[model samples]
Target: MAANFSNSLVRWIDHRLPVFSYLRHAAYDYPTPKNLNYWWNFGSLAGISLAIMIVSGIALAMNYTPHVNHAFDSVERIMRDVNYGWLIRYIHMNGASFFFIVVYIHIFRGVYFGSYKSPRELLWILGVIILLLMMATAFMGYVLPWGQMSFWGATVITNLFSAVPLIGESLVTWLWGGFSIDNPTLNRFFVLHYLFPFIIVSIVLLHIVALHRFGSNNPLGIDIKYPNDTIPFHPYYTIKDAYGLGVFLILFAGVVFFAPNFFGEPDNYIPSNPLSTPLHIVPEWYFLPFYAILRSIPDKLGGVISMFGSIVVLLLLPWLDRSPVRSGHFRGVFKIFFGILLIDIVALGYLGGKPSRGMYVIFSRLATAYYFAYFLVILPVLSKFDSSRLLPKSISTPMPEVNGIE
Candidate 1:
C-alpha cells in the first residue's frame, strides 16, 4: 500500500512538474558509451568533490571571522573549540587539493581521448572557464585564514595586476578596496570566497547539460554507431562511478585523518605580519605551474601576459589542432609528443615550488616554451601530417582478449 501510494504521488508530480521524469531521463536512462574506463570516473569524482567543498565550507564559515585581526584566531578557535570543527576544517582544507587532483585528471583524460574535439568545443571551453573560476575561488579562500602565506601571497598575486598598462594600479587598488592589503581586502576576499562556489555550481550545471547533449566520449574515441555501442548510465556507469568513489574516499580519508597538513605550507601557521616578509613565498600546489610560468619571463607585464595566455591557449585548442582524428590512442607520433608534454608540465609544477633562481629558471623557461609550442606549433603542424591508425567501427566492436581472459 505504501509503495503504491508513493508511485501514485510520483506520477501526480510527474504529470505537473516532471522533475522525476527529468531526472530519470538525465541520470538513469541516459545513453553512455559502453567502453568507458576508469579515467572517465574523474568527472563524477570532481562533482562529488565540489559537493563536499560546499558543505564543509558553509560549516567552517559559521565560526570564521573575516577580519584580519581575528581571522587567524577564529580559525584556531574552530580547530580547538568548535564541536567536530577540527574534522570539518581538515576536510575542507584537504578537500581543495583532492578537488584539483580530480579535475586535473579529468582534463588530461579529455585531452588524451580528444574529448575537446568537434561538437564538444563549447563543452571544452566551459570546462576551462570552470577551471579559471576554481582558481579564483581557491585564491580568495586561501586568504580567509589571514595567515602569513595568505597575506603575502595575496599581496604578491594582486600586485601582478600592476603589470597592466594604464589601469593596473587602479585595478589593484579596487581589488584591495584600499591602497594595500588590509581589513578591506580581507573582507572582500571573504565575501567573494563565500560567493564563488555557488557561481561554480551554476557553471557545473551548464557543464552537465552540455556534456549530456553530446553524450560522453569513450576510450576508443569512436562515435557510437549502434544500440549495442551504448549502455544505460544507471546500473552500469553509476555502479562503476560509485566503485571509483569508494577508492577515492579511502585515499582522501587517509590524507584528512593522517596528514591534514600535507599540502599546506608551514608559513601559513604564523599570523600575517606585513612588516616581516618570509624567506620564501609560494602559492598553493595547484597554482605552481602557472606561477612558474609567471616568474619565468623577465618582464613583469610579459610574465603576466604569458601566465594568462597559457590558459587562453586551452580555450583555443579545439581550433588549434586541425586533425581529423580525435584520440591520441590512434595517433602514434602524437602520443609520444603528448607524453613529453605531460612530463614538461610536471617538471614545470615541480619548478614552480622551487625558488626562481639558477637551474630552476632555466628549466622553467624551457618547459614554458614547450608548453606553448606543443599547442600552438606542434599540434597545428602535426595535424597537417600525422597519420592515425584505423579506428574500430563502433564501441561494441569486439577485441582480441588480453592474457587469454576471453
Candidate 2:
C-alpha cells in the first residue's frame, strides 16, 4: 500500500514539476554495478558529509559575527550563552575533517578501481575541481574565528600568492586589502567561505550528471555486458550506503563529543596576536602532506610551486596511468606501488606537523620525491609490464560462497 501510494504521488508530481520522476529515475532506478564494494559507499558518504556541513554551518552562521575584534568572542558566546550552540559549532567543526576523510577515501577508491579512465575522465576531473574548491572553502572558514592560528594561517597562505613573478606583491596587497591581513581579509574570507559550498553543490550536480552518463566503474574494472552485471541503485546499494553512513556518523560523533579539539591546534584557542607569532605555525591536519611538500623545497618560490603542483598533478592522473586494466586488484605490480604511495603520504603528513629541520626535512624531501615519481614515472612504466590476474567473465558471475553467504 505504501509503495502504491508513493507511486501515485510520484505520478501526480511528475505531471507538474517532474522532480519526483527525476529523483526516482536518477537515484532509485539508476543501474549500478553489482560488484561495487564498500569502497563505493564513500561517494554517498561525501554527499552526506557535505549536507551535514552546510546545515550545521547555516545554524552557526546565524550567531557568528565576522569581525576581527568580536569574532573570537562571538564564538565563545556561542559556546557559553547560545542554546545548543556548542553542538552546532562542534558538528560544523568536526564535520570539516570528516568531509575530507570521506573525499580522500572516495578519490583513493577511484584510483584503485580505475574510475578515471576513458568516458569517466570528466567525472574524475570534476571531483578534483570539487576537492580544490573544498580546500579553499575550508581555508577561508578557518580564518573566520580570528584566532592565533587562524590569523597566521591566513597570512602564510595568502603570502604564497606574492611568490608570483610580476604581480606577486600587488596580488598579496589585493588579497589582504592592505599591507597585512586585517578586517577586510576576514570579512571577505567569511563571505567567500559561505559562498563556496553552494558553488561546490552546483559542480556536484554536474559531477553526478557526468557519473550517470557513464555509470559507475566496478571493482572488476570491466564493462557491464548484461543486465545481470548491474543492479538497481535503490535497495541494494542504498542499504549499503546507509550502513556506511551509520558507521561514519559514529566516528564523527565520537570526535565531536569526546575529542572536539583533537584535530585543532592549541594555538587556535588563543586570540590572534600579530605581534606574538607561534613558534611553529601549522595548518590543519588535512593540508599537512602538501605543507610538507611545500617546505621540502629549499627555495620559497619553488616550495610554493611544488605545494600547488602536488594538487595540480592529480588532474593528470587519468592520462598518467596508462594501464590497460583499470582495477589494481588485477595489476600485481601497481598494487605494491600504490601501497608504498599511501605510506609515503602518511609519512609526509606526520613530518609536516613537526619542525621542518634536520632529519625531518630529509625524510620529507625523500617522500616528496617518491610522491611525484609515483605519478610521473612509476605508473607510466609499470602499466606496460605489470602482470594482471584473470578476471571473472561478468560482474554477476557467482564466486565461491564465503562462509555460507552467496
Candidate 3:
C-alpha cells in the first residue's frame, strides 16, 4: 500500500507541473540572515491577523443582509441568534484593532531599522497602500451598523468630495446618489466593505514577497557582511517570533473576551435618523489625528488638503532623511526631534476627539505645521552634521533590553 501511494504521488507530479523546477526552487532557496529577532516576526503575525479577519468576515456575510431598512437589525440578529455569533462578531471587531496594532509596530520597526530606504522603498510604499485599504475597509464596516454615528460619519466623510474646486457639489450628489445620505449610500458601502479586504490580502502577500526578495533589516540598521554577525532564518529567529506572537495573541484574546466594545463609540448604539443628528459626530479613534488635521483650517478645501498632506508626507520620508545612517539611535539631534514628532501625533489625536473650535483649533494648526516641518525641514537638516557617541566596531556585546524588546 505504501509503495502504491508513493508511485501515485510520483505519477501526479510527473503529469502536472515540471517537478525539477519546483523542487530546485524549494530546496536551495536564497540565503536569509538568521540574526533577525522578534521584530521580523511582525510581517508573519500581520499576515495571520489579516487571515483571521477575512475568514470571520465571510462567516458574518453569510448571515448579514445589506439594506438601509434591514442592515442594523440584521446585525442585532447575528449577535443574538447566530451560533457563535457573539464570538465571531467580537473576533472580527477586535481583529481590526489587532491588525492596526501589528501594522504600526511593523512600520516603526521599518523606521528603526531603516527598512524604508533604498531598494525597499517599493516594499514600504506597498505597505502604506495596504494600510490605506485597511482603513477604507474599516470605515465602511463602521457604516454597516446604521447607527447614529454611522449615518452622520458617512455623510460628513463622503461630503468631503464637495471640497473639490470645480466639480465638488456634483461629486457629493453623485456619492450620495440623492440629496442626502440614504439607502444608496448604505448599499454602496456594503459592496465596498466586502471587496476591500480581499485587495488588502493580495497586497499583503505581495508585501511579503517583496520583503523576502531583499531579505530583512536588522536592529543595528546594517546588513550582515561577516559570518560572525549572521544566522539562519529557520530555527534561531522562528522561535523568537513565536514567542512574540504568543504574547500579542494573549492581549488580543483578552480584548475580544473581556472588553469588546472598549474601542467603539457609544453613540453608535443609537439608530440613525436623518432629521435628528448627534451632538458630536466623529470618526473612529484611529482616524482622529487626521480628522484633527482636517478641521484645523477654516476653509474646507484647505483643511482637506492639509489632512491628506499628513499621509502624503510619509512617501517623501525615504528621500527626506539625508543621513547615511538609518535610525535616530546614534543621531543626537534626531532623537529629540523624533520624540517631538510622536508627541505631535498624540496632540493631534487629542484635539481630534475634542469639539471643532476654540483652543483645540488653535493648538491643532500649530501641531499640523510642526508635523510638516519635522518631515520636510528638521530631518534633512539634522542628518548631515550632528555629532554623536558611537560604539567602536569591537564593541560587539548585545544591547540591554528595553521594555522586553532586544
Candidate 4:
C-alpha cells in the first residue's frame, strides 16, 4: 500500500508543478530555531484558520441568496433547513473573530520580537496587506446579512470615501456601482468577498515563502547566533504549531458552540431598511479603534483621512523604528510607547461603543492623537534616544543556528 501510494504521488508530481523540492527544503530538511516558542506557531495557525474560513464560507454560500429581500431570510433558511447549518454558520462567524484574534497576536508577536526588522520587512508588509484584506472581507460579510447594523454600517462606511475632493461623489458612485448601495453593492460585495480569500491565500503563501527565505526572528530578537538554537521545520515547528493549533481549536469550538452570537451585534438580527437606522451602527469589535478615529473629527473628510492614515502609518513602522534594538525587553522608551499604544487602543475601543457625543468625541480625538503618536512621535523618538544593550551577531554566534542551512 505504501509503495503504491508513493508511486501515485510521484507520478502526480511529475505531471504537475514542482513541489517536493520546496517541501523538502521548508519542512523536512529546512533548519529553524530550536529555541522558538509556541508563539512562532501562529504563522501556520493563521494558514489553517484561513483554510477553515474558506471551506465554511463556501458551504454557507451554497444556500445564501444575494438579493436584499431574501438574503437575510436565506441565511435563516440555511440555519433552519440545512442540516448542521447552524453549526456551520456559527463556525464561520466565530471563526472570523478567532481569525482576527490570532492574526492580531501574530502581528503583535512580530512587533514585540522585532519580526519586522530587515530581511523580514517584506513578510511583515505582506502581513499588513493580509490584515487589510481581512478587514474588507469582514465588512463585506457583515453587509451580507443585510441587517440593520449592516445597512447603516454600509451607508456610514461607504460614505467615508466621499471625503475625497472632486472625485468624492464619483468614487461613491463607483463603489456602489450606482446612486447608492443597493442591489448592485450587495452583488459586488458578495462576489468580491468570496473572491478575496483566494487572493489572501495566495498572499499568505507568499508571506511564508518570504519567511522561509529569511528564517524566523526569535523571542529575544537575537540572531540564531549558534548551532543549537535552530532545528528543522517539520519536527520542531510542526510539533509546536500543532500544539498551538489544538489549543486554538479548543477556543474556536467553544465560541462556535457556546457563545456563537456573543461577539456579533444584536441589531444585525433585523433586516436592513435604508430609511431606518440602527440605534448605534458600531462595527465589529476588531474594527473599534478605527471606528473611533472615524468619528473623532467634526470635519468629515479630515476624520475619514485620519482613520485611514492610522493604518497607512502601520505600514511605515519598519522604516520608522530606527532603534538599534529589536525587543521591547531592552528598549526603555519603546516599552513605554508600546504601553501607551495599548492603552490608546482600549480607549479608542471604548469610544467606538459610545454615542458620538461631547465626552466621546473629545476622548476619541485624544485617543486618535495618541494612536498616531505611538508610531510617529513615540517610535521615532525612542529609536533615536533609547539606548539598547549590545549582543552577539548572526544566527551562528554563541547561539548556534539550528536546523536551517548555514
Candidate 5:
C-alpha cells in the first residue's frame, strides 16, 4: 500500500539521519505548559516574521545594488520595473516593523510571567543578544536604501562612537571604511545585513534547545509538578499558532497593500545628499526609546553608557529581582510598578520621536531615571519586602483567591 511504502521509506532514511525523529521530538512530541495564553503566540509569530524577512531580503538583494551611487536608483527601479519587486520590497519593508512588534510583545510577556528566572537565565540572555543583533542588522539595512534619512542617520549614529575616550575616531574610521560614509561603507553594510539573519536563525535554534530543557513558563508562573499540567505541542499549540498566523497575515497584508510607507520617513524617498542635512533626523520607531535615553544625558559618553545600560539592566534582571515568586499575578505591587514602567517606556518613546528641546528633554530624563530605578531600586526593594500572595502548587493547581487574581 502507498501508506505502508511511505512509512517504510521514512523509517529507512530516519534510521540513517534521525532528522525526522528530531523534528518529531522538537515539534510534535515536545511538552508545553497548558496554561499558556494568546500572549504566547508572539514567539511563533516572531519566528514567522524572521522567515519572511530572510526570504524577501534575499529576493530584494538580487535586484539591489549596494553602492551609494546606484543604491537609490536601483531601489526605484525595483519599484518601477522589476516584476513583483514592489510587493517583495513592501513585504520586507513593513515586515521589519511587524517583526519588532511581535518580538516586543513576546519580551513583555516573558517579563510579566517571570520567564527569565532560575534555569532560564541563559535563555533570557540569548533573547537579549538576539535583540541586540536585530538592532544591528536593522541599522545596516536602513543604510542600504541610500536615501536622505539613511545617510544622515548613519552619520549621526556612527559619530556616537567618537564618544569613546581613546580609540573613538579610529573606530569610526574603521566602521566607515574610510574618512567618511561612502561606497565602501555601503558595501560592507550590505554584506553584514545579508549575513546577520542567518546568525539569528542559529541563535534561535539554541533558544529553542534551551527552551525545551526547562519547558515553557506559564501564566501562573509555576513549575509543572503534575503530568497533566502540560500538553503535547503539536495538535493543540500548533493549531493555535496557525490561527494567530492567519490574523497576523491579514494585518500584514493590509499594511503592505494600503499603507506600505506607514512606518517610513518622507525624507528617505529622496537620494542621499552628503552636503544637505535634514532638519530633523530620527531612527526607526523601534529605536526611539533608546535614542531618548542616549540624548537625555548631558555628556556624550554618559549618554552612550546610559543607552546601553538600559538593555544591560534587562540582561541582569534575573539576579536583580530577588523576588521569591514569579508572575506579577501574585504580586500586586510589582504588577502596578510594571504597568508604570511600561508607561514610562511609552513616554520615552514619544519623547524620542520629538525634537530634543523644551519639555521633551526634561521628561525624557525623568523617564530614563525611572527606567533604571524600576529595575535597580524598585525590583530589589520589592523582592525583599513586598507581600506577595501565596503561589499555587503547580501549573494545573487551582489558584486560591487571595484578592481575586484568578
Candidate 6:
C-alpha cells in the first residue's frame, strides 16, 4: 500500500539524514490533547500567515525601491507595471493584518484557557516576544512605503523616545539617522524590515520547541489522565488544522483580492511631504488600543511609560493570575470580567482611532484604567474569592451537546 511504501522511503531517508524521523515524530506521532477544538488551530494559522507574508514580501522587495524620493512612485509602479505585482503587493500588505488577526486569536485562546500557567509560562512568554517582534517588523515595513502616513508615523513613534528625561531628543535624532525622517531612515527601515522577518522565524522555531516540550493546553485545562485522553497529531489535529487553514485562506483571499485597502489608511497613498501633515494620524488597527493608552495620559513621559506598560503587563500575566483553575468556562465570575475586558479593549481601539479630545479622551482614560485593573486587581481577587464549577474528571469525558456541534 501507499502507506507502507511511504514508511519504507522515510526509513531509508532517516538512515541518511534523520529528517524523516524528526518530521514523523514531530508532526505525525506527537501526542496532542483529544479535546482540542477550533481554538487550537490559530497557532498553525499564524504560522501559515507568516509564511504567506514572507513569500509575498520577497516578491514585493524585488520590485521595491527603498529611497524616499522614489519609494511612493515605485510602489505605484509595482501596481501598474510589474507582472502580477499588484497581487503580490496586496497579499503582503493584507497579510500583515491577517497575521496579527491570527496571533491575537491565538493569544486570546491562551488566556481564556489559562495556557500561561505553570509549566507553560515560558511558552506564553515566547509568544509575547514573537508578538513584540512582529509589531516591530510591521512598523518598519509600514515606513518603507515612504507615504505621508508612513513617514509621519515613523516620526511620531520615534519621537516618543524623546520623553526620556535627558536623552529623549538625542535618541530621536539617533533613530532618524539625521535631523528628520529622510533617506537614511527609509534605508535603515528597509534593511531592518527585510531582516526582522527572518528573526521572527527563528523565534517562532524556538516557540515551537518550547510548545512541544510542554505540550498543548486543552480547553478542559486538566492534565491528560488516560491514553484515550490524547490522540496522534497526524490524522486528528492535522485534519482539524487543515480545515481551519482552508477557512482562513478563503477569508484572507477575499480581503486581498476584493478589499485590499480596507485595513490601509487613505493618507498613506500620498507621497511623504515634510511640510504637510495629515489631519488625523493613526497606526494600523492592531496597535490602536495601545495607542489609546499612550495618549490617555497628560504627561508625555508618563504616557509613553504607560503605553509600554500595557504590553509589559502581559509578560507577568502567568503570575498575575494566580487561579488554580484554567478555563474561564468553569469560572463564572472570571468569565464575565473577561468579557468586559474584551469590550474595554474594543472601546480603547475605537478611541485610539478618533481625535484625542473631549469625551473620547475621557473614555480612553476610563478604558485604560479598566484594562490595567482587570489584570492587576480583578484577576488576583477572583483567584482568592470566586468559586468555580466542578470540572470533568478527565479530558476524555463526553459532554452534553453544546453549540450544535457536540
Taken over the whole model, the C-alpha lDDT of each candidate is 0.91, 0.90, 0.79, 0.83, 0.91, 0.89
Question: What is the TM-score of candidate 1?
Answer: 0.96
Candidate 1: what lDDT? 0.91
Q: Residue 375 error for model 3, in Å?
A: 0.9
Ranking 3 against 4 by lDDT, winner: 4
lDDT of 6 by residue, 156-227 (tens): 899999999998899888988998889998998999999989998999998999888868999978777888
For candidate 1, the per-residue lDDT at 32 reads: 94
Candidate number with the higher lDDT (2 or 3): 2
- How far out, in Å, is residue 229 in model 3? 3.1
Superposed Cα deviation of residue 19, candidate 4 (Å): 1.5
User: lDDT by residue for model 4 over 184-258, one digit each (tens)?
Assistant: 999999999999999999998899889888788886677665666677888767777888889999988988898
For model 2, the run of ten residues with the poorest summed lDDT: 397-406
Instruction: Give lDDT tens digits, candidate 3, residues 296-330.
Output: 98999999998878877877778887677654555
> Would you estimate the TM-scores of all the predictions?
0.96, 0.95, 0.89, 0.92, 0.97, 0.95
Q: How good is model 3 by TM-score? A: 0.89
lDDT of 1 by residue, 359-384 (tens): 99999999999999999999999999
Tell me, by TM-score, which candidate is best: 5
Residue-level lDDT for 94 in candidate 3:
83
For candidate 5, the per-residue lDDT at 102 reads 95
Better of 3 and 5 by TM-score: 5
Per-candidate alpha-carbon RMSD to the true structure? 3.2, 3.5, 4.6, 4.6, 2.5, 3.2
Question: Candidate 2 lDDT, tens digit per residue, 223-279?
Answer: 888987888898888899999999998999999999998889989999999999999
Over all chains combined, what TM-score does candidate 2 have?
A: 0.95
Candidate 1 clashes: the total is: 0
RMSD of 1: 3.2
Per-residue C-alpha lDDT of model 5 across residues 1-406, encoded as one tens digit per residue: 1222258889787877787888788775688899899999999999999999999999999999998889999999999999999999999999999999999999999998899988899999999999999999999999999999999999989999999999999999999999999999999999999999999999998998899898888887878898898898988999999999999999999999999999999999999999999999999999999999999999999999999999999999999988877788788888899999999989998999999988999999999999999999999999997444477777777767754554
Identify the superior model by lDDT, candidate 1 or candidate 4: 1
Weakest 10 consecutive residues of candidate 3 by summed lDDT: 387-396
Extract clashing residue pairs from model 6.
162-168
